[model samples]
Target: MQQRFYDQVPAVVLGYDNALEAYRSDKFASFPVQPDPGGVIMAQNGVWGYYGATPTAAAAQSTGSNTGLVVAVVGGVLIVLLGGAWLISRRRGARAEDRE
Candidate 1:
């Protein structure tokens, strides 16, 4: 295990599996010795914030998959609204032409 210093805290990257599943097993039980893509950190009798924790990437731990997903959802809604507007305008024009 390689020692890594972060925020002046000495830490180690563990080789455990993903935390999502382990955590899913029992969130309370998985409180310590978490899992992440970076790996797992089995604390060796040391106490610190998130010590003996799992390695999770910022993206992986996010509520959403990515910022792009936010944009995609917004864009899709806008596209649907715009398409409906265009269809309505076309229908109105057709009616106007028929009246003329």
Candidate 2:
């Protein structure tokens, strides 16, 4: 049980020396340890767990490509303008025919 507990729980939770002491006192089982927020127990590379630093604003912003977003916005504007022009031209043609 002692070996299993040590294998399952990281020493960082209570610090190595404290963890050993807790185990000796039979208090380790009841000690509260926070769960991993990311829900990742083990990494693909066989690493015990992920301990990565939080990303900065600049790093987060650079991950995505803005080209697609810009293209979509430009395409939407062109469609609206072209539709408006077509509607105006059709109205003018109808007016000219009525005057004939």
Candidate 3:
């Protein structure tokens, strides 16, 4: 049923300040009405997330530079290297114990 589908969908509410910012943007044109300044903006599309009253300068900088992807790649490489080193050490320790 339609009610069941809606009940299972995730949603979020944006505070008035953030709602106003989203309302003014062309990107958020799907919003049906002009949200009240003192009220909340409910997600009609059943999407779940948060948005601040205004985009932060740090977010803008990081997005344009693809910093998150770079950081993730570096972190992943570090984890793999550490895991390999740990495995090698464990194997060496086991061999030493076997020989004693």
- RMSD for each of the candidates: 15.7, 18.4, 11.1
lDDT, model 1, position 90: 100
Worst 10 residues of 2 by lDDT: 20-29
Specify the poorest-scoring 10-residue window by lDDT in model 3: 26-35
lDDT by residue for model 3 over 1-100, one digit each (tens)? 5566567863533233444334445233233322343444454333222333344355345436678899999999999999999999999999999999
Global lDDT of model 3: 0.57
lDDT of 2 by residue, 1-100 (tens): 6677788975635432322212222211222232444233333244433333333445455466789999999999999999999999999999999999
**Clash count list over all predictions:** 1, 0, 0
Alpha-carbon error at 11 in model 3, in Å?
76
**Which number leads on TM-score?**
2
* Deviation of model 2 at 90, angstroms: 0.4
Candidate 1 RMSD to the real structure: 15.7
> In candidate 1, how many clashes are counted?
1
lDDT of each: 0.57, 0.55, 0.57
Pairs of residues clashing in candidate 1: 14-40
Q: TM-scores for all candidates?
A: 0.37, 0.39, 0.37
Clash total of candidate 3: 0
Error of 3 at 86 (Å): 0.3
